[model samples]
Target: MERFNKSRVILMPCRDYDEEEIYRQLQVGIRLLGGLEGLIEKREKILLKPNLVRKAEVDRAVITHPAVMGALARILREEGYENIICGDSCGIGTASRTMAGTGMERQMEKYGIPVTDFSHPVKVDYPQGHQAKQFVIAQDALDADAIINVCKMKTHALERVTGAVKNMYGCVCGLQKAKGHTLYPNAESFARMLIDLNQLLKPRLYLMDGIVAMEGNGPTSGDPVKMGVMLLSADPIALDAVFCRLVDLDPQMVPTNVHGMQYGLGTWKTEEIEVFTPDGEVSMEEAVSRWGNPGYRVDREKYGKNIWNALKALKIFQKKPYIVEEKCRRCGICVESCPVEGKAVTFKNGRENIPVYNYRKCIRCFCCQEMCPHKAIEVK
Candidate 1:
């Protein structure tokens, strides 16, 4: 297989979402990657795919920072890339609402870029895929000539950490994302499908907003923690591997990084990847010593396919989502997001009651937890 020269990843020190500072760092990162002239064309329709998981205030760290997206848009427009648009298929609501709720809509409007509707689904066939042969992605994403992934750095209930690679799942289109959780159901299988999706879309660049990241319960509904850095790479796996090192987690323990290497998507090996900063290239040890957060809260456990993952008696061995009655708004977003055919989570007792889950039918997909707006659902 022909492998990409995805060895170099740049980490820029950025403590906050200052647009000018972000623009300067982004320019430096792009220059370090041999510049945008060679990577994307001005005539191509570019899609800015951000990790807009759902609507939340910027300070909440629930979605990619609007400042980062704004800075990138400015860079692209200044470089003569006028054919640009931005969007993401969120967990529960329409893409427009998520973007608007996150303040991304206003930011894009400043740059005269329109938001793309991700409600339209288009199927693409990939017979050579290792795990999935077909994907029904957002029409805008499929139609884009090139994509620039702007992802958030955060922990995820099912995937451990949701970074560059996992962010692409947003392209799966509205309810299909919920359905995908039911289909793959496990970390490894879901990751393989993500890898296949990346292979199919082939995003041109990846930029991660790590200055402010979510820890503990995340991808949504987590506390904001500062990592004080921004990351850039053409390789999603390598970018995510660097994320792992900074958080003091083992890259091999992440299913996407492991399968990403096995399937020739990108390399996570410390020896194979080179990390850079404004000063120069640094050893992984030095990089970790300078920036690594040993105290960072994230799931570092290795997930494997076993009978215990399915059996109700062995539920302790598995992470199951439960409703926290105090925080639940009883809006039923959790029940609505549950993809199980018969509805694994439902307001069986009454509409006035908090939604309940049938453990026997639950797939442990964390859909309910992920879509819960009030931080009412927790996995344990």
Candidate 2:
């Protein structure tokens, strides 16, 4: 825990997803973090975990850019690390399909990195966990000596911002991820569980692709807005804190950032983080001044246990997901993705009819919103 007393984060400006450019910038960022030699062994089994939420093109900014992943793989291979794999559990479909859809499968083939659906869930007990004492982790993750989290920067309906910390939720195999919402329905509890998972897995490094980030309603369904930045760090919390700063969001308002500090995952306190660029060490304020997007469309309101959340009967007062009848494709993915008992969303009218949400059963987990392929569901 004391190792997190002071954390270093490297922030670099990236205009686009040009493979060569990303490779060069990543090389500098890794070097700034004292290189991977001292941290990861050359022969150690490594897992390059990317945020493959679901099937979508790279331009959508829904998942981590394949170019970033390929560049990281190329760098590792250059470092004499031949044993490497890339994997993630997609939110709504097979990992293979999502990988192919996002052009990640092609990138992996180019780098000779095997892709896993993160199959074979293994029960791992973590008594030290403050929120979750045990977890069912993917076998690939459990076997890896080190994990390099390659996550995307996007707004999330549940967590506000899904960056380095929340990215690890994909470590939970397939349907278990949906079930997790049932276990930890709210942002605070869910974030505590995420902190526990990070503490348990202890990924070697965290990298965020922020050149183009999703905004409005995101994590999966949202519009892409160019932010022109990339972030890297050993501490997920500090890395995410820098992400918060770039979007003009208060890091303290993010549940993961708050619980991460309390549970010793890493520090979000501005004083405890050392943010820098290739020029020299710079203040968080300076980092924002250079690449910050004060106009970025993210929920900046403080999410406390207030009347808004407490008054469930007043559904109109809360931020709940509603279907845009015109956009609804009647795919029933929302119905299938709902983790609540008896299903919060169902085809109440008929199989051919649009699914309806029983708000009474809805946990406001936003699984329906997150998994909706069409831009039908939006929380307002």
Candidate 3:
């Protein structure tokens, strides 16, 4: 019996002005890997899976940039690779809602790419296991001959950073995502589950949209920074390593990357890997210095201040909602989304208003944070 060889990763900087130029640069990177022709056979069905986490605008850095998808699809079409479809199963909601809320539907129409909802799913067993016995993946994702994983470069509250490796979680289909969270419970276990899922799916190609990246508390509500870079790879682990380095993050600290290497997914150490750029070649250190890490840095002063406030406002500020009033619509969705058995969050007025959260009973699962329709909730 023969062993499967590890995949290769290609890195490129996107200093281009617009979408077409960025796409062309990505094409250059892919060409280094024997081009898309080798990856996509003639008349084979291809699935372009992007990181559409929830129904949020594209510019918010919550999902993959439509421009990147359009560019990749255009390049595929030119190469005679038809039967392309765009799809994703979100974190806690339906793909349809994510598509509509994120304006991905409009992008799909513009590119003439069919948007698929991976709703009806099938179970796939993994013989060599790290955590899970089987996963319920969307049938279309499993059946496709080729899958192009398009992921947004963003920070995650749990996994640290969600990139090429983490995007494969979308393949789980629907609410199975939330269920996976419940099953794994902790970040370390959840990351192990992700590695197992990636091994099972084995996407043909992976692309990271780093032109604009999310920093701080993300994968959703983070500040968008201009990274002006994009990455392509067949090896998800290698790509994640490069992403980590680009952001000045220790790859070992990232749960997904650490577990991925342990599971024989790909290499995490920068010393063993080689990177090829679109123009003049540069080291991972230089790229990170130029681009800057998008992960959050804790403010010691702010932490001290919050502690003082918690002590001072013992009643109201004990566990008060640190709402981003700018982002808050006061829709009271968080109040309703709270799963407290005793109705911890109750309306202040007769009409819909931001409900006060009971600090003692708050599970801190961020279910309220995850389900907030208005993106209002935050933990201090």
What lDDT does the true structure give each of the candidates? 0.88, 0.89, 0.73
Tell me which of candidates 2 and 3 scores higher on TM-score: 2
Q: Residues 161-190, candidate 2, lDDT per residue (tens digit)?
A: 999999999999988898889999888899
- By lDDT, the better pick of 2 and 3 is 2
Give the per-residue lDDT of model 1 (tens digit) for 213-297.
9999887988899998999988889899999999999999899999998998888988888888877888889989988898889
**What lDDT is reached at residue 279 by model 3?**
65
Top model number, lDDT: 2
Instruction: Give the total clashing residue pairs for model 2.
Output: 0
Candidate 1 has which clashing residue pairs, if any?
none
Question: Which segments of candidate 2 are over 4 A away from where they belong?
Answer: 1-5, 304-309, 312-316
Best candidate per TM-score, number?
2
Answer with 1 or 3, whichever has the higher lDDT.
Answer: 1
The lowest-lDDT stretch of 10 consecutive residues in candidate 1 is 304-313
